[model samples]
Target: MQAISYWLKAYGESHQNPINQKIHKVAVPGIFLSVVGLIWSIPQLSLFGFSLNWVWVAAIPALVFYFWLSISVFILMLAYTLACIGFIWSMEILNWPVLPISMLLFGVLWIFQFVGHKIEGKKPSFFEDVQFLLIGPVWVFFKQ
Candidate 1:
C-alpha cells in the first residue's frame, strides 16, 4: 500500500518536462472524463429502486482506493468523480452520442499523452504500474 505521496512522486518523475506537464494538465482530466463517459454509456441496471451503471459500479473501488490513501484525497476524488458523473448524466439527458464521443476523445487524449511522454523521454509511469492510471487524475487535478 504505497502512500499518496509515493504514487505522486513516482508519477511525477516522467512528467518533469514543462511541455509534458502542460499537456498532462489538460489531457489527464480529459482522459478521466472520457473514460467515465465510456463507462456511462453502458446499459444501466436497477437494483432496489436505484439505477446502477458500469461507471457507478466502477467508482466504488476507485473511491476506496483513494480512501485507503488519505481522507483528503478521498474527498477530492469523490467530488471530482461526482462532477464527471454529473457531466456524463447531462450528456445522456441531452441525447448526446456519449459512446462515440468518449471513444473519439479517449483516442485523441492518448495521442497527446504519448506525445508528452515522447517529449519527456520517459515512458509513462503507468507502464511500470497500472495503479498509476488511478493516481494520474489526482496528480493532474490538484494534488500535484
Candidate 2:
C-alpha cells in the first residue's frame, strides 16, 4: 500500500499537467457515474439470491486503491456510495435513457481534461501509464 501511494503521488506530480488536473476534477463524478451505470446495466448479475451486478464490485478495488494510494477512506467511500445510488436510481427508473446520459457526462468530462492538458502544453498522463486512468478520480478527491 505504501508503494502504491508513492507511485500515485509521483504519477500525479509528474503528470500534473493542466489538462489532467482539470480532467481529474470533472472525471471524478463522471467516472463514478460510469461505474455505477455499468454495474446496474446488467440487472441479473446478482449474488446471495439478490442481484449483485458485479459492476458495483468495482468499488472494492477503487476504494482500496484510493485510500491505499492518496485520498481518505471516508471521502472515497462516501463518493462511491453517492455515485452508486445515483446510478441505480437512474437505471431502475430512467431505464435506457440513463446509459446515454451517463455516456455523455463521461465524454464531456474527458474533453475537459484534454482541454486542460492542452492548455498546460503537456500530453495527458494516460499516454504514459494506463494506471493513471484509475488514479484520475482520486486526484479529483484531493482537489476538492
Candidate 3:
C-alpha cells in the first residue's frame, strides 16, 4: 500500500479549486453523518440489552483501514466516528425519523458533491480509485 502522503497527493490533484475545497469541507462531514445515520437506522438487534445495528459492524473495518494508514488518521477518525455514532444515537432516542432524514441528507449532499466536482472541472478521485471515497473524509479532516 502507498503511504498516507501518496494518497493525500493523489486526492489533492483535482481539488485545487477553492470553491470545490470549501464545498467539500462542509459536504463531506454532512455526507458522513447521513451515511452513518442510514446504517444506524437498520433494524437493530438486542444483544445483551444493547441495540446493535449495522453501523457498528461497518465501522470496524473502516477504522481498521485508517489504523493501517496511520495512527493519527486512526485516532482522528475514531474520535469523529464515535461522535457521529453518538449523534445518530441521539437522533434515534429523540425519535426524529432518522431513516427519511438520512435519506434526504444523503441525496442532497451527494448532489452538492457532484456539483463541487463540476465546478472543479475534473472527475472525482473516487472515479479513478474507489478508495478515494474513504480518503475523502480523511483529506477534509486530516490535514486541514
Over 10-43, each residue of candidate 3 has an lDDT whose tens digit, in order, gives: 9999898999999899888999999999999888
TM-score between model 1 and native? 0.95
lDDT to native, each model: 0.93, 0.64, 0.91
Report the number of backbone clashes for model 1: 0
Candidate 3: C-alpha RMSD to true structure equals 1.6
Q: Could you say which candidate leads in TM-score?
A: 1
Q: Rank the candidates by lDDT, best first.
A: 1, 3, 2
List model 1 lDDT by residue over 1-144, tens digit each.
999889988999899999999999999999999999999988889889988798978999999999999999999999999999999889989999999999999999999999999999999999989999999999987635
If scored against the real structure, what TM-score would every candidate get? 0.95, 0.69, 0.94
lDDT by residue (1-144, candidate 2, tens digit) is 445555557656645565566556666667667656655555556567786656647666766666665456446765766666665676678556656666777678767766777767777667877767766655566553
Report RMSD for candidate 2: 3.4
* Candidate 3 segments exceeding 4 Å error: 45-51
Please give the lDDT score for candidate 1: 0.93
